[model samples]
Target: ESAEEVIGELRPLLKGILREDKKSIPDMNEDEKIMHGCLESKPKHIDSITRAIQMTPGKALSVLLSLELKGLVRQSDGKHFSLH
Candidate 1:
C-alpha cells in the first residue's frame, strides 16, 4: 500500500485509542501519551504521524528508529515506515 494509505489507516485507530486512554488515565504529556499509544498500536509511518501529539523532527525520527529496532515497524524508504 502507499504511504498515504498506510498513514490514513493508522490515524483514526491511533486517535481513538489515545482518546480512550486519556479518559481512563490523566496527567500524561502529549508526546508521552502519543508515544505510548503508538507503541501499543504499532502504527505505520509514525515518524510522520502528527496530531494532538507533536514532536520535533529529530525526536520523531528517533522514535521511528527505536520502533524499527524493536521490530514493530519496517523501514520502507528513507522517508517512510510500515507496520511489520
Candidate 2:
C-alpha cells in the first residue's frame, strides 16, 4: 500500500497506542495533536510531519518532502504519507 494508505491505516492505531502509553494525549491543537499522535507511535522521528502539522499547506508539503528524505515516512500516490 502507498504511504497515504499506510498513514490512514496507522492513524487510529497510533492514536490508540498513544492513548494507552501516555495515558493522555498531548495537549496540542486539533491538528497538532493528530500529527503528534501519529508520529509518537512511529519507529522513527518525523520532523516533517510535525512541521506539516504546525505550518500552512505549502510549508507542510515541504515538511513532507523532508520527512520522506529522512526515511521517517513515504509519500503516497497522491498528497498523503505513511510512517516507515
Candidate 3:
C-alpha cells in the first residue's frame, strides 16, 4: 500500500486507542498521586506538586512527563502543570 493509504487505514484505530486510553485513569500509584496534586483549572508550580505528592522532585518530574505523554496533564510556564 502507499504511505497515505497505510496512514489512512491506521488513523481510525489509533484514534480509538487514544480516546479509550484517555477515558481511563492511569493505574500507576505515582501517576494517580501526581495527578491529584495538579489542580483542576489552576496551574501549580513543580515545587508545590512535589510537596503535595511527597515525592522527590526528580521522581515527580518523571511521573509528570509520563502523564503529559498520556494526554492527562499539561505543563506550562516551564515548571507549572495542570489537568488537561
| Global lDDT scores for all candidate models | 0.59, 0.56, 0.80
What would the C-alpha RMSD of candidate 3 be, to one decimal place?
8.3
| CA error at residue 75 for candidate 1, angstroms | 1.6
* Model 3 agreement with the true structure over 1-84: per-residue lDDT tens digits: 999999999999999999988867665575666455565668889898888767789988888888787777888996998988
Task: Candidate 2: list runs displaced more than 4 Å.
Answer: 1-54
Q: Could you estimate the TM-score for every candidate?
A: 0.42, 0.38, 0.60
In model 2, pairs of residues that clash are: none
Roughly what TM-score does model 1 have, to 2 decimal places?
A: 0.42
| Descending-lDDT candidate ranking | 3, 1, 2
Best by lDDT: 3
RMSD of 2: 17.0
Candidate maximizing TM-score: 3
Cα error, candidate 1, residue 1 (Å): 55
Deviation of model 2 at 81, angstroms: 0.9
